[model samples]
Target: MPTSTRTVAEELLYRIGEGDTERIAELFADDVDWKLDWPEAEHGRPATPWIRHRSTPADAAANFRELAEHHVAEGAATEVERILIDGGDAVVLGEIRRTARPTGRAYRARFALHLTVEDGRVTRFHIYEDSLAVAQAFER
Candidate 1:
């Protein structure tokens, strides 16, 4: 028997949905490479705040802070639609029901994330999501 990568990924996704940033950090390796790609220039102001390129857990904490401060809102919710894991690699498909703060606008989007897990820790993370919709939500 072995530690199922899929199970690990599922727990990770669950923690994310729970808004448990500390638990999320505990799941990452010391030197984790996390990236959220949303070109600010093209996506506009709203998407600008959430985009990040972090190389460590500390960096991820900062990114999460920014997300919580600006992007994550009271009504925001995440649903994991699917998860596929092969060895140390995993892909998660999900949807976000988010409402941008201050403006209180709907910024719903679907997303897919690729994650690499080794020794029960996540080493790499890359996410793809609908940035245009987020930008549009911020439009005033």
Candidate 2:
């Protein structure tokens, strides 16, 4: 039997938790447009350094490195607070708790994601996160 989109989405979260960008790339379409809409908390600067509008799987994978250069998730944990699926689309409500690398500042944030799975691969992904909290954690 074919895998359900919901199952794929859940597995994607698992891959994220593992910091397995290669596996995460496999779950996206070749031409996936992945975006993280982290708001700007500083003038001309984004809250999270890895805010992305990745247009390809390789581009999406690079986001992990970019993020690591800015902040690391030590003792990070996430909970899928809710998931709703309809046909090829899914919405995930999630929360994350972690200590930032170097700084060792703790961060707790909630997020929501809208995903579109096509041909069993994610074609589109858009996530909204608590940018203010993220910015504060990285503040020096």
Candidate 3:
């Protein structure tokens, strides 16, 4: 049996929570439409290193690794409020809490992730989050 979109989405969340970058990358297709809701030009402050443009699975994995490197692992958490699936698309609503390693500042931000699955692999991954709060947390 082929994998369902819901299953793929659930597994994505599980892998992310486990900080398993390899498993997470396995779920994405070679060419991914990746986007994060942070516009550096409008924000004045530069985006965190992890907010760069990514298209390949390797880039996706590297992004997560870079993010993990800048955060404190001990108290990092993701509280998923709900997941809505429609055909091949899934939208995950949640709140993420993490401490910036350099500043030792914690930030909790509401987030929404939209994933589009095709042939059991995610092709589109778009994330919307409170970028201001996250940026502030990393401020020295």
- Top-scoring candidate (lDDT): 3
User: Which stretches of model 1 miss by more than 4 angstroms?
Assistant: 1-3, 40-47
How well does candidate 2 match the true structure, expressed as C-alpha RMSD?
Answer: 2.7
lDDT of 3 by residue, 1-140 (tens): 23799999999888888889988899989999998898855433343788877999998899889889889999899999999999999999999999998899999999999999999999999999999899899887
* Winner by TM-score: 3
lDDT comparison, 1 vs 3, better candidate:
3
Per-candidate Cα lDDT values, in order, are 0.75, 0.76, 0.89
**Candidate 3 Cα outliers beyond 4 Å, as residue runs:** 40-47
* Candidate ranking (lDDT, best to worst): 3, 2, 1
Global lDDT of model 3:
0.89
State which candidate, 1 or 2, has the greater lDDT: 2
lDDT of 1 at 42: 57
